[model samples]
Target: MIRGIRGATTVTNNDAAEIVNATEELLWEMIRANDVKASDVVSVLISVTDDLTAAFPAQALRRIEGWTYVPVMCMREIPVPGSLPRCIRVMMTAETPKAQEEVVHIYLRNAVQLRPDLSLTRKSEL
Candidate 1:
């Protein structure tokens, strides 16, 4: 069996380093919460707000983790009026023996405002 874990996070600015850092933080949390390993990850799909083209969050993840061979794709998040800016979101599908209810999803930083109850864990598990 397998499950999908969706996580979202936002940066306060468009700086490349900041975007990478924030994205790294969010991704690490998601990976940790679900106990995901390189081999367990089926694929990682990432999207970023229109205002944040400083770098691709997916590339950032690959660079930091040295997951050069992982399947990673990046797209721009639709720009909607009054939407959160400088945001990076991910939909990760992994090969797991657990059900959806057993997988931990993460939503962090200002994105936490989207799901207060599901916003985080003391584990920084996002």
Candidate 2:
């Protein structure tokens, strides 16, 4: 079966270190939430809000996780006026036997404030 987890996070600034750390935290949460191993991740797509371009969040994850073998790509998120700022979003497609509803999604930081509907586990994980 194929399952996917989508995560989004808002950053306070455009610093590279901050970007890397925030993305690392988000990706870590996503991995742990679904019991997703490195091998389970089929591919990961990342996008940053227009204001953020210090470093690709995908590259940050690659460096932090030492994921020399994971397929990752990064792009710029569409900019709409008044949209979330300094945000890095991830959509991960994984190969798993679990149903779609069983997959875990992550929203972090001020991003959590964006989706109060998610469960406590999801809220606290990131």
lDDT of each: 0.80, 0.81
lDDT of each residue in 12-98, candidate 2, tens digit only: 989888998899889988887887877777889999988887877776667655566889999998898987788888998888777
Question: How do the residues 1-126 of candidate 1 rate in per-residue lDDT, one tens digit apiece?
Answer: 667888889888888888888888888888788878877777889999889978777656776565667798999888899988777889888898878667877888788776676655433542
Question: How many pairs of residues collide in model 2?
Answer: 0
Kindly report which residue pairs in candidate 2 clash with one another.
none
Q: Which residue pairs clash in candidate 1?
A: none
**Distance (Å) between predicted and true CA of 76, model 1?**
0.9
| CA shift of 68, model 2, Å | 1.5
**Which 10-residue window of candidate 2 scores lowest in summed lDDT?**
117-126
Candidate 2: list runs displaced more than 4 Å.
Answer: 64-66, 119-121, 124-126
